[model samples]
Target: MTASSPTKQQDTNHFDPSAPPPFKVADIRAAIPDHCWIKNPYRSLSYVLRDILVILSLTFIAVVFKTSLWLWPVYWVAQGTMFWAVFVLGHDCGHGSFSDNPNLNSIMGHILHSSILVPFHGWRISHRTHHQNHGHVENDESWVPLSEKTYTALDAPTKLLRFKVPLPLFAYPLYLWKRSPGKSGSHFNPYSDMFAPNERRYIVTSTLCWTLMVANLIYLSTVIGPTLLFKLYIVPYLIFVMWLDFVTYLHHHGHEQKLPWYRGKEWSYLRGGLTTVDRDYGIFNNINHDIGTHVIHHLFPQIPHYRLVEATNAAKPVLGKYYREPKKSGPIPLHLIDNLVRSIKQDHYVSDAGDIVYYQTDYRMVGKKVE
Candidate 1:
């Protein structure tokens, strides 16, 4: 019933693919204390304000200390970390866990998400899709692996692109623009296949806000000069992309075992949600509002971020053998880099057709695809 350690052998791993988990969703939900479910608007907004204040403070210090080129590295890390925290708060809004009022969540979601160049409604809808289909092969949004047939069908360039590090790490912006492989439609486009007709207006509103943010940056560049703007925003924005890609990719992809992807009747909301692994960001557990408590967040997105840890502790007994213990981490999660590299090297694709499937590596395709 204990969580498995990182060093455990893959064959000895606890998850049994042949049978469905014994526990039911309601059982786990009932295990959590009632108080953990309450979402306090004031408490949520306090996090928003805290991240904004720190972000602005970092920017001000970097701008005034511009002559000290040496400090730019420190500024970039601090600012980028704060940017990720802001995104997490906005993420809470998208899930409707920030407050009881829909209007306030919308307004705050737009302000926080758009500032970071995310199209709020666009991302919200797709993210909701991700949550719904997390363990399904074809249906999962974001970081689902390719099937062997799909991988072989990809052009040489794309096959290569899929496994490379820095390139994949920077894929967030491109994903927002076009989405993942085998998926069509843009997060920026309301008419894209991912959205419904009624949802188009929300997508357009978010897109315009993103446009305005771009325009503001353009104007700022004209006044402050490109160098300062680059130092202040562009560099940090790329870092934010790295942070986003790093945290999310590991959540579902880099476990010791090749995590199963479900299909057809085998899939269920609780099963899909359990496929996600919790992570430890050490001190960053609070700085980013406990986002690394991902297993519980996936199980119950309605629980506010601040309450995820409490809910997670309460649910662990119920989760028992089902929970995948995260590898412990330092201030930064450097340990995961090994998991990431190993996955990229070996976990290339799953079988094309199966109710349950594990990743399959193409030995010939491995070295050839990473260049």
Candidate 2:
């Protein structure tokens, strides 16, 4: 079928599709493996507290203590890793994946995601929607795709900058302001996309709370000599943004693995996720909170990150060839290449059905052309 054709059928054989899976709801009540569920609330609390302590230990040394003069590398790397863990906790809170209680989730989510400068409920709502529509180009809340015409409309110069320069140069800074208040997207408003602007009460309240927190930190920075704030807080937060862009980009944007689309309301969860790749990143898996198991996460987000691997292992038989894990070990340059390739392809769903295919036509005359 051509790009604009209204065909409702697709080449199912061209992609690995599965029955809607991970079956988290069905799996939730199943006998969880020992130590999997964290039945003890104290243990859950300790895990969170431990992450905090590690963060503080590293950050204090780097910013305040400054004692072990040779410890700067250890300080920065350790603090950055802990921040990643903290982000995982915040993510769990948003999913209510860390605890059985909603109130606890809300409070923890505010503390974690807000401290990192994201609007808690606003992102939670979008991220939750992302889980629901993970693979659907138009519907996936976060990594939603762009159309070919839309992709092609970019002039050559703009494309060059987007791939060759801007992605590395200004992407992280852009994410901060983009996710901040009153930007192109909803300004910290969860209901903004789905409801009337007047319905964003929770958003406004939480945003004010975050603003106050930032203000208090800024004030403390003066007494602490601004050095602590910049050394510990500001630099780490920027690193978090860098991680965020990398994680989100390589997950779905540019993998050559899978592409599936449906017309109108015919969308199926199985086909939407076929393109996910199993990135072989070694042990950095824990650092990214096993976001590598993105396929299972999208299938059943309620499954906590800690339990995701087990869930994937158990369901792989059922998911069969459809299963995908993000290729974890690809170097930054490989990732950059992969991303550029995906960005310009059929980045979004097309009206017609065919294979999950990618092709680029170069019109510049480099050699004799075949008729």
Global lDDT scores for all candidate models: 0.85, 0.57
Residue 122 in candidate 1 has what lDDT? Answer: 97
Candidate 2 structure quality by residue, lDDT tens digits, 222-312:
8887876776677677666656655665666535333444333445555565445444445567666676676666666667777878877
Error (Å) of candidate 2 at residue 11 is 12
Q: Residues 56-99, candidate 1, lDDT per residue (tens digit)?
A: 89988987888997889999988998899999999999999999
Residue range with the least summed lDDT across 10 consecutive positions in model 2:
1-10
Return the top candidate by lDDT. 1
Model 2 CA lDDT for position 79: 66
Poorest lDDT segment (10 consecutive residues) of candidate 1: 1-10
Off by over 4 Å in 1: 1-10, 13-18, 368-371
| TM values, all candidates | 0.94, 0.74
